[model samples]
Target: MSRLLDMKEFGEAAPFLRKSDLEILAAQTVAFDDKPTKNIVGAWILITDPLCAGKKRAWIPDEKDAYIEVEIREIDGDKVIVETKDGKTYSGLFCVTVNPYKWLPVYTAPVVAAYKGKRRSEAPPHIYSIADNAYNDMLRNRENQSMLITGESGAGKTVNTKRVIQYFAIVAALGEASSKKGGPATKTGGTLEDQIIEANPAMEAFGNAKTLRNDNSSRFPLKQNQSERRRGKRLLPSRQCHSYTREALMIIQWNIRAFNTVKNWPWMKLFFKIKPLLRSAATEKELAALKEEFLKLKEALEKSEAKRKELEEKQVSLIQEKNDLSLQLQAAATEKTCRLYEDQMNESKAKVEELQRQLSDTNTQRARAQAESAELGRKLEERESLVSQLQRTKNSLSQNIEELKKQLDEETKAAMMAEELKKEQDTSAHLERMKKNMEQTIKDLQMRLDEAEQIALKGGKKQIQKLESRVRDLENELESEQKKSNEFQKGVRKYERRIKELTYQTEEDRKNMARLQELIDKLQAKVKTYKRQAEEAEEQANTNLTKYKKIQHELDDAEERADIAESQVNKLRTRTRDPGSKASPKACS
Candidate 1:
């Protein structure tokens, strides 16, 4: 009774709540973080044992069945990556699906039916699961529920939405509702369900084509639907209002109390007591008493009218005060909005300027890197072409040396046989020494060629110097062999011409080998220098690419901030109306 009276005494006023008295502090909430007031609208609630935080990535501990259990964990994002690799598209409340781009058995009738009564937690994460939860919540709370299906273009938002709609169609169906409403004589001449289902294809083809920038977007019907159903839904709110029901109820209660008090009056009791005695004696005293009562009732009625008029006037005064307060509130709200938008716009402008400066610096650096890379690239290509030509020349020199060496062996063998026929032992000994020196020089030349092919600059240079000294010794030996041959010219006369020709050919081959060795050393050195330049160029290019990407990202963020500022400006413009321009409400007759 005391609580009732307290409530009645405090009637018709909005309730008051302080921040400290708000119900935001639950057992799970450890503390409120109000330090970050600039970005978010409200303070953040700090909680303990968060499922995922403070980690780059982690795989779920349960490796065997990550798909079966999508609950968020202490691990950050590794489990999500692993799940994607294993074809698990959903993680907790988020349905991160890929476009299968084809029909699947997952959304069949049986599957839709399976999710009808099950709670979201009872099933694996899916679009149907979300829809089922929404439906269940709407039924349980007697309120509407909305699910936003939003993503970038080609993200299957439409496909997922269709699945949700199909799920609802199956789950919220009244048994044979179509047949009961649109029987055989209906316009479609089919079950009401069929006509309803047919309307959806037309709607999906055009109405739900994302014509509106809002949730559950639909196109306005013009040459479309042309149905009474659409017209009936165009009702607007009524402008008429009535007297406060609370005040009316209070007036009724007062009148009832007054009537009860009058019923218990002493005059009423005396009249009942004297009714039988005065029934036959019609007297002027009774008439005078009745007249006095009528006058008293008339005065009472006049008083009630005055009291009612006073209450109406009081109500009007309260309404006037309320209107003034509303106007003040609107002004304050408008000012706050303007201030907030101005701050945001200023911050956004500063950020954009900073980003532009950074981008200009990045462009300068990129231009320098590109210029250097282009110059280096041109030089490298030119050197590479020279290296290719040198390589081919070196190969031909090597082959020619091999053929000349074979000729030397044959000519030496023939000269030895001719000397043996004449019994020239001294010449034979000298010829054997020349053959040994020639073989040693040939081995050195082969080593140099091998080093050249490998582009070993230091090793090939050393080998080439050794070959030069060896070639000089071989030339002196060849001269001695020529003199020895002259000593045995008579005994070995038949092979003299062949020996001279072989000597001349050997010297020419020696000169060619020396030139090839020099070319190999220079090629090896150029290759080393070119390789270094190429590496530097590649590293610079990578650095430039990374810088460009970073600058682009910052530029994108700046653009988004600027867009937000502009949108806020637009919102303020829409809401900042002239309070005095509003007309007074029209009174009903």
Candidate 2:
């Protein structure tokens, strides 16, 4: 649970396990948790055994046959322990998947790491080696076992599968080397196996490629086996894997069998030479041996025109001989010189002439019959010759038609084969280009990831440095604030000292005000004494004024008259108001 929790915390790490980072541990060292008291982490087991199958190409290990299992255990607070079914345990940081059985080489990790250097071939051991070993065991013991492999499409399933099969074939073919002994086994040996191996490179170059799931997938079609009826008209059972081809030995065997059958047929046919026909069998001793056999056919044809001509000449000679005999008989009768003899000669001539007439008529009738027969024979022979010529012409035309059809068939087959080969080549080339492109893409992604990691490291360092600087500045500012707080305390002490001094000065000013008020009252009493003396002097002057009043009355009357006169004079000067300012100026002048 702790491992699972840790993985959950680090989520991205779980899903992006590269092939280079993943490792398959050995079966023996793996341990499983069996105690009920201990916590279970996970189960580990071996899922495949490449060496079990008789055919190396058959890569799937049979589950019912064999497997290795392991279980992981957690102990104490920080320790992880692995315990196996065999009662073995270990303490370490461990990685456990569902499968633990298959023992892959430890060098796989380093080899995978070298992919950046463009070297991928060395990572894991080829399955072919295991297959070869397994195949050897089977052959040595005369045993056979079926192999099965199951995996998702792109996980090197087909490639591993092919390697297993190839291993088995190579191992099984080893005995074929002995066939070089010039015995029957020599025909079955290395030459045949070498050809098969050669064919594989060509097929792989054509059929394998990069699909969405697999970097190198094969595109071969499933071969189907079919049963065909041959000319023997018998059921010949045979076995073929899909797309199987017949071996060269099988073809040679078929031809030999066909040759033997043709020699044992029903007819006894002859093939004598044509030159022996020209020589006469009677004169040539060697030819005489065949005389009786061929002479009868020659005689039948010889009795034709030549024999008829010879028979006509022989009939003429016989007629001329009979006339000569008749003339002699007539001369003998005349030599007798008697009258009866003369009468007999005359009778003989008449009989001869009558016989001649009958002979002539017979000859004419025979000639006419022969001419009719010859004409009929000629017509029959002409018809037969025409029929024979027509048959020969028909045979020649049929042979030419068959030959033309065969040539046309061959040309058509060649064209079709050429088209098929071109298509296969094009498909193979396209797949190769795709594989190259995919590999390039994978390399680019790896480089980008490395660049991102570098950028993140630099940013993290800068952030740490900034935080450190901020902390130092805050420390300095705190010291300055403490110093300002001490200065404020000193200023409060000075203000308290000044406040006490002002209180004393205020009390002294109140006392001085009371003294000034007393001085002002004494000055007011002195000024009242001087004012009483001046009142006495004013009483004496009032008596004098009463006596002087009588005299002043007379004088006042005189002064009144003087005042009136002055008033009159002033009126006379102001007598006329000027009508115009210019007239007033003339009067003043």
Candidate 3:
């Protein structure tokens, strides 16, 4: 009845449209109630602007614009509706839809109510739930299956597809955690490090494209991180998940190489033929002018072929120049490598010479120490000989002193025994008899007594002096022996202490010698290891040098290839740059 929607109106409505606005009014619904009803709610209603007035038609809206189909039935004053497109249903008071966002809460309320007993709606349902279910089904029920997402550009299709992948990653990872020890994880091992090193070029190439709408549109890009914690002797695990956001792009190029780039290709059958009539109508000119264009086209064709041949020749020459450049670069690199090796060789020779000098000095020091030690041994032997002679003299003097003391003790004991025996005889009789005998004997004894008295008196003085002198001599000898003994004991103690110290020094020297030997062994091993490493390094350097030379050659070859391509391109361009080119060609004979 009113002016129908135009392109501007449709565009605006797509973004901001109310459900009630597209629906038939309550008055119209009541009028049509008795007949087969055309309820606007949940029904497709097409509106078109016809050039001719008063003619109307309805067509089904495909998944082309903002349209969805629903099924509804009335019960008293309420409408029970199922959103067939998204598989959701609702029961509510029969009223025309006004706001979709506002109505979503109303529609999903019934689903919430139905599932409330099971706590199925504990978390708020988001758009991702659909994708989550699909992901689970694919992984659990349909393993090895593929998912295809087809849609027009900028329809949130790519975003939805990414959401599906995330759903799989999250749910599967959680499941893996429940089954495995250490939970949802990522690779923190060396393999991941290697992969990261390898992925640089892939990211650069695939995720870059120029677009008018988007300055740089990336199809896929990713970032990864690994974290590690020491758990006792082992490292704890980590988790990784991919998050993706999408943007739409405009003005993309499509390749026509297989289809339309060449004539009489198999795919050419797919396109409609261009007859002479169609071609004739494209230009506005007379027959004679058209023939003149045909002749020009022939000339242009010939010129193009000549340019092609010239480009090919130039390309060959450019290749030869690039090869020559490569050889020169390789030669320079070899000279530089040889110079570096020579420097290393000189340094090694100098180090060897210095070590030899040090070895010679150490040998001279060892010889001098041996001579000094031998002199000390000779002095020690002489002192031992003197000690032995002094010990023999002291033993001889002790034996002589012992023999003299024994003889003096025996003489004193005999004199005491004779005095006791004389007192034991009969006293008076013996005295009277002895008196007569004594008187007679006295005269004879007197003479003997006088002689004995004379003898006793003379010997007493000499014997007394001799005994006194002998006592003095013995006391001096005993004092000297005691002093010598004390000296010997003191010397023994000193020598014992010295021996103990020497024993301790010997043990320490042995330990030190062992440690030194160990250190020398370790140093020798290290020297051998370093030598091997140096040799390996030298070999590796040579290999790398070879590779570098090869790369230089390749670079030269690439340059030559580039030069050749450029020359060919230039020659073709020059040939094409004539004053005029034919626009048309004559028909085949």
Give TM per candidate.
0.29, 0.18, 0.19
Residue range 153-268, candidate 2, lDDT tens digits: 34445555554444333333434343354322212235644544433422232222112113222322221222344412222221222123245435556887986776465441
Cα error of candidate 3 at position 39, Å:
99
Error of 2 at 57 (Å): 45
* Root mean square deviation (Cα) for candidate 2: 78.1
Residue 163 lDDT in model 2?
A: 45
Which has the greatest TM-score? 1
lDDT of 3 at 284: 54
For model 3 the local lDDT of residue 464 reads 55
What's model 3's lDDT at 47?
26
Give one digit per residue, the lDDT tens place, for model 3 in 288-376. Answer: 68899999999999999999999999999999998998877865665565555455545544544554454455445444444444444
Per-model CA lDDT versus the true structure: 0.61, 0.43, 0.44
In candidate 2, which residue ranges exceed 4 Å CA deviation?
A: 1-74, 78-124, 143-146, 174-589
In model 2, which range of ten residues has the least summed lDDT?
A: 111-120
TM-score of 2: 0.18
* Model 1 misplaced regions, further than 4 Å: 1-337, 424-522, 578-589
Descending-lDDT candidate ranking: 1, 3, 2
Native-to-model Cα distance after best TM-score fit, residue 512 in candidate 3, in Å: 2.2
Q: RMSD to the native, candidate 3?
A: 35.3
Q: Global CA lDDT of candidate 1, please?
A: 0.61
Of 2 and 3, the candidate ahead on TM-score is 3
